[model samples]
Target: MGRKEDQDKVQSVLELLKKQAPLTLKQEKFCNKACVERFLKAKGDSVKKAAKQLRNCLSWRDSIGTDNLIADEFSAELAEGIAYVAGHDDELRPVMIFRIKQDYQKNNSQKLFTRLLVFTLEVAIQTMAKNVDQFVLLLDASFFRSASAFMNMLLSTLKIISDYYPGRVHKAFIIDPPSMFSYLWKGMKPFIEYSQLVLVVSSLDFEESFEFNDYTSYPRVTSLRFDPSSIPSTKLGPCSSSRFSFTVSHSCDSVKPWYLSLTDTSASKVGPTNSSQISLGPVISPLNARSQSFASPIDRGLRRNDNFIRKGFFPSTPMPQKTQSLDPSMIHHPRTPKPSFLQSPALFFRKDYQVSRVEKSRDSFQSFLKFYRRPYDEMIYRSKMKPPLGGLISIVSPQLKRRHMSISQRF
Candidate 1:
């Protein structure tokens, strides 16, 4: 059929599902029109068959508690590392990588394995970008060798994906597959059409294409230096907050400043509402201001009068009101004290000998750079076994020795 006819068929199937299929409100919201199209396409455009398929899927999902599987299955760290949601392909489709370890075995029931697969697929589906609902499955089968039961479980999981999760995985990349995997691939090859499966004998191409190591299989989602939004903290394992290199966003509501108690207003009133009008006082100096009196307070019998202090510092002539305003350039503010570092005048001056030392260091560094830029063959005149130390004595002049001594002393 043509594309338009197929779309009409899908629409008809969706209408039929709404009328006949038994689906909950949650299922109806989760399963969009594109999902019904998948069911119709999987069942050969037969409305009754597609409706039945969707109803069975809904019933199975409800029975197995598929919603809680993501939360419960991630407790297994190995499983999380084995199958994770990588960043994306060039086409912007979500890429899900699954690698089976060589020593891994199914000790539990098949139900657990199935649930894990379902949970992984759901995560990939949820993480897909806008206008892109398909996924590319990158399977590493290097370690999955000579295990018939494990192979059966894998094929069965593929079968479930093909039957229920239609149109989800559009491409499959098999990496470092052994010769035995060809038989398995040939058996299930006919179920999916318009889907391509590539078997790679060498993992080099896979690593280059996806930018991941074969053994480590680190996730590309968080591996990029720029992008930090894809991978969750759970998948990376328990990372301490102190060790994280990226900035974490947090609300300032619970964070109280160190000077909050010293402010004039209560901390509750210091919210964002009064942010425009609040003014902070200058920092107080711990050193006491020098008293004018050289004698101790005990030696002074009576308190000094204000006129006695003014008469000693000010002139007796009547001052104009404008002059009494006090020029800021002449009078220093007693409220703000200078720190000890800025109080010394010697710290601000640069000596001429220090300038000469800096110039000498720069010239030496430039000479070193010029020597470093020369080719190795040009830099080394000839290859010598062990006589270079004795020959260096001929070129060692008194000026060179003095320069060496000066350089050592400067360092």
Candidate 2:
């Protein structure tokens, strides 16, 4: 149903397809004005390019038997729902999700995975009704451990969809790409049209890009009503609620942490004990249990003493019984003097102390350390060197002595 002015342009492409492809009964029945227009647009309205694209599509159908792809025969495999034609976007374009981990082949062969993928996509293409020619794809790569396992499969799929199935994807949303994607995408991106593909890094990004209310408010171009119930329950995205958000609010509690699978081959290492013969403590008598609750040194003065306890330089905790049990003579011993040094600036810059700060502050400090490693290392080494610098500065510049001492001690 194109405008009157577009009839000749459409007919020109149709004549080219007839000459190049020579449609059979099935191809002739499949040929439609809308489908033909998509080919023309995909090839930038060039009859030669459009004919070539259409010819490739015909060849692909012949080789793959796309007409024979039925969902019923693959029900057992499809029950796992590796890929499916689910709801439609605001434009009535079909939405499909490709989950890598759920669909990973047990034999770990890319061939089997590709067959399943192509079958699912073919089934999805069949769901394209009337003038709706394209589908939206949501690629869930969150569970994929490495891109090397599926990079080639992804490339091949993209090639098939772009070359043989031109203009079949209105928009594609790729979700939760593995850490390796940043490196692999550099090469794969050039082949993909950026206008149709969106690499979503997080749920927040997904919500920002697409939402249900967006298309609802805009004036309707056709008589398409979005049926909420038609959308399947999706765990991979945040659109579960009515908000039309794609935030990742839910996780499968039954599945263990992904890293647990990457552990040592020997599978007998689950425990709280030091089963690997790793010694964790010196086992000094438990004088007191230091409360792990940590805050600023000023706010938790007594708690700061754990720094000394960790190094076995001071009693773990000053319980009433242990303090009373100490011999009267040893109570005031010069060597056992209270670790007044706990308040010294030297305690502030210790790696352990810095890492124990509030979570945000600790993360910021750690990130800073990554960029300023050389300066930080030199300062820390200078700080640990005692006597010469600490005392010499105290004597040479008495007025600036405290500032120098604090900076040196903390470093």
Candidate 3:
């Protein structure tokens, strides 16, 4: 369809939606021209279908109380780095990364997972660049094993995105997927409308293709701000000794490549130095020195305490202590052996005990029957039991039962 025709269809769909049900203030803010256009494109430019979908989307958003959702409510999930909006892709579309390895099936609650998914998408939408309505998804499946356990959650999330937030996924890349991931993709392919947009690539290919620089770092919550002016002036650099140990520069420009820069002075040195030779002394700041000192002993390559040797290590085994030699006279004679079961059967079994093979077999069969029939027996007994006289009287006439049974007991 031509651009003008598409615009007309979008407008008609918007008018139809309005005629069907008046949008509230919140819905009005959400149902913009872009949103209507997305729905139209999702519904094959059919005016009635698009309007129906928009109505359903609005109703779903209202039921979930989407307007009231806040990032603080999902702080735990966000902190785990399971899902978050980070840097943008080569297309300038905001990228949302999902670390499948960090998702624990034990802690998975469908409701909370849905909320987290919606919250992450909202943040990604807020961070999107102008004229970019869709976002890129990076599924980091490295070392992820419990795909079957998470299939339900994953399918539900896909359903929500496809049904409500149509045309919002520009592309999805599965990074470093395990061997078992092919099965997962097979299951997910049916739910995904734009299968061509989903690609499976190695970590290296993802980095080179997407140009995502900070893939390893955790997303800063401050980056979710829609206004660029609210962002900090300086971006955080890579950590050296500890998480807090990072270099800061005044300029907001991207860092220069190490190969391009002849000297390392720009990264380490505070000011121009006289010596032509590269120096590492100035790189260690007072804060970095403290951080290094407080760092883990294993990370710092320091020897662990002798008392804290690792389990199964050579040093952890107990050593034999010195003792005097034992003499024959010091050793006591061994206790007399007990009578065998065959020699003195009376000691083990009761005096009146009798073995009857037929009785034993019959008892076993009877026990098995009882075990299987217990539930049916209980149901029959319950059916035969009479209803309380108070309840019967209340059903026939309340006044007659009121004198016999108190209200609390009758209930």
- lDDT digits (tens) for residues 284-329 of candidate 1: 1122122326544432322222333322334688766774466679
Stretches off by above 4 angstroms in model 3 are 1-3, 101-105, 187-191, 204-411
What is the full ranking by TM-score, best candidate first? 3, 2, 1
Off by over 4 Å in 1: 1-11, 18-22, 78-80, 102-105, 147-150, 187-200, 204-411
Local accuracy of candidate 3 as per-residue lDDT tens digits, 1-411: 698898888789878988988878878889888999889888888899999999999998887777766644654555566666555655667667776453554567666777777777876776677878888776666746656544554556678889889999876655566677669778778756766566665544222333223322323432543666766765554444321334544455647422211223335434334444323222333333334567655434322234544343245757899687888899999999887657656656744334553344343223122111111122212222122311232235424444577899889
Ranking by lDDT: 3, 2, 1
lDDT scores of the candidates, listed in order: 0.53, 0.54, 0.60
Model 2, 156-190: lDDT tens digits are: 66777777667787656555666787687776677
Among the numbered candidates, top TM-score falls to 3
Q: Give the per-residue Cα lDDT of candidate 1 at 146.
A: 61
TM-score between model 3 and native: 0.48
RMSD of 2: 31.4
